[model samples]
Target: MTPEDLAPDVLTDAAAPIDPARVSDSLDHENTLKKDFVRRVRDCLEAGESDTVYDLVEPLHPADVADLFELLDADERPLLAKAISDLMGSEVFAELNDHVRELLVESLPAGTVADIAEQLDTDDAVAMLEDLDEHDQLAVLAEMEPEDRAAIETALSYPEESAGRLMSRDCVAVPEHMSVGDLIDFLREGHDLANEFWEVFIVDARHHPLGTCQLSWILRTPRHIALTDVMKRDQTLIPVLMDQEEVALRFQKYALISAAVIDEDGRLVGQITVDDVVHIIQEEAGEDVLLLSGAGEGDINEPIRESYLARVRWLIANLLTACLASFVIANFEGTIAKMVALATLMPIVAGIGGNAGTQTLAVTVRALATNQLTASNAWRAVRRELGIAVLNGATVAVVIGIAVSLIFGIPRLGAVIALAMLANIVIAGLAGVLVPLTLNRLKADPAISSSIFVTMTTDSMGFLVFLGLASISGLVG
Candidate 1:
């Protein structure tokens, strides 16, 4: 039966009544909800009791409701949605994970989806519509109020993940010619405005943002002062096409509370507040980390099919790279067979080197992401990694060398392995830093392919160094 078939009272009765104290404790004690709470919610949905489910879930904060939506099984979501139709507010939609929200919207009727999108801010409305199929998107847009539809359509015209797409259109902007008194009077005159704003952008006749005057400054300055006179001219005006990451960097670099988003002709369109930047910072940081591992997004709320697709391609690339390393190892098979001990000791060298390379790769990727490593200091950073590698190799060589010598009772063999260890590790350090740097130079996403290539280099080189050393030194008869 459909989700709508569920009766509200049945849902409430089926849901195990959770104590308010328990709910409070769950929220306070952990960043995520307990499984029992999720089970109860799920059971309520499964029982087809809409009223009971609504009563049980109605107390949750919007974010918590979003989290609950994410935690539910895909098949159960529509049922849950039907059970708590009234509770599904704009705040809940805002908090829902991108993938889950998209799924929920796609599952609902076009008119229902449009009704929800109309309630969201312009940026969020654009985001909600952007992911839908063209036909579905058009259908939903057609159902929205004309003004909101136009605003969203205007935002959608910009590139995805840009300031134009991310910034809310509901911002405060006033003509630069207005006096502080006029600005204050305008604010007091009760024009419907955004719920919050840190600064008011001063725009010219053509709508070009001339400067910005913070609310604090306007409140403290003399009422007779012209807004243009007091406003800071050197403001960080974000081009509508600027990427969200760059937008965050601008906010961070200038310590801006709010910045004006300008269109192609430098006309002020909207303002991006620090709150928006906070989400951008979080999303971009997480994206970088996941991309470094070739994990793609890595959101738990992601659909199974999408997650599988994201990771499978990376795994396939890794498998291919692994085979290349195997080919290198095959070339040294004779040496390994002659000295069985080589097989035992060989993995240690390669594994250690791989670990070392990974450590360097992680740091380098992070540095590049934060713009801490640049052309001016790239060589300096590379040199520093080289020096660190030398120290690490030396320290690890001494320990492994002595241990191998005592265990195998062969001093010369120990020396050969030790030398190999030193060489492989130094190579690991070099490859780790250089591979990503090279990828960056090639204009590739260094995070996506660097680890695979770096790992391959360390593993192949590690095996070759240890086995080649052993063979050349006659340690393997």
Candidate 2:
């Protein structure tokens, strides 16, 4: 069944038409549902008043309805879904958090899941199903109509998060020979056209996109004006295999509302709209931040086991690095015995170096993510970071050196600590920038393990430099 078939059934109780004033009352100035409003719904649900729960939720916008689902307890989610089954439309499903949606979907029947998927755009449908286990996915596809199933199956065949999977099959494409007037007439009469489109793609007989014309351009053109005459010859054609992040970058760089997705032979297969790219950009940005901290997804609703596995592995790696740092300190036990002040002052040097390294690491990762750092300018970026590092090192060293000398009255000890601080901070800076650049060059996501290595380098080198310097500077001897 088509999405249109499901639209008429959603929020159609005309006897109780939505009141804008009541909808506003449910939300606060921040746009989130008011606490008392949520509490009332929970009370009704607990009292087993399904009709009352439905009444409370019916006036909400689909996105607000989605937020309500997330705010409810996990068990209450299935109950809420049942109470407002009609209002659980495609838009609400599209707005639901991924983990919450997965849980709510699993409680639903396969037929119900298929119906919801059919109502969504191709990309949203794929996102809904991609997280399901293979058996459950097959079951849902089995219940779907042949045409919808075929489109989703084809999208699933592509790599996850690729343009082929993200692009919608519904788009306006016409033969290059058509006039603007002819295209307009055809669009008015077409029964199965896309629900929303920004531009008309003009294509050759083989369906290779020749150019594109905005809707406004067609409407203002004379009837006799050929489409090719008005269509801009240049276009950004996204390859089907291109990653979604790259696709988002292209859209942003070109300020595009929509772009054609082309297959291997350069034939237009589908189109990706700005709405889809907006979601991708948000997801990718969050994903990079979470990965940098080794907290996979960092989503509160993620399964406990999955979160544990993702975090424990990173913690274990950190533990190993900490051990390596400890090994450096172990080698200088006698140095610390000769001067106990060395023990007290060593941690200060390592801590400052770590903070400096983290600052550089965050900047480098962000630059690489946004494509600001590249092969042509990588050397320049390295030099820039090092310059900043040296300035930072000199400034921090002077302050700590003065403080140590004033408090302890040991000018020689202060001098040793100052030199060590400057050395370690410079080393931290080098490690921070070089580690990520090296990982990027090796085709690895620099955010994944760059923090771990940079931390290790700062910690180990800080201890070794400070203790080794103190032992040889005649302060300990």
Q: What are the RMSD figures for all models against the true structure?
A: 3.7, 3.2
Q: List TM-scores for all candidates, in order.
A: 0.93, 0.96
Q: What TM-score does prediction 1 earn?
A: 0.93
The TM-score of predicted model 2 comes to: 0.96
Per-candidate local distance difference test: 0.84, 0.91
Q: For model 2, state the Cα shift of residue 356 in Å.
A: 1.0
Question: Evaluated with TM-score, which candidate comes out highest?
Answer: 2
Model 1 Cα lDDT, one tens digit per residue, 1-477? 542343222112123445676467446466577777788788877777767777777667778889988989888888888778766767778888999999888887776777777778888788788999999999888888898889899999999989999999988988877999999999998567877888888888999988888889999999999988899999888999998988998898889888899888999888888988999999988988898788888998877788899899989988998898789889988888887888898889999999999999999988887788877899999999999999999999989999999999999888988898899889989988899888888888888889898888888898888888888897877
lDDT comparing candidate 1 with the true structure: 0.84
Residue ranges of candidate 2 with Cα displaced over 4 Å: 1-17
Q: Model 2 over residues 355-381: C-alpha lDDT tens digits?
A: 999999999998898888999999998
Best by lDDT: 2
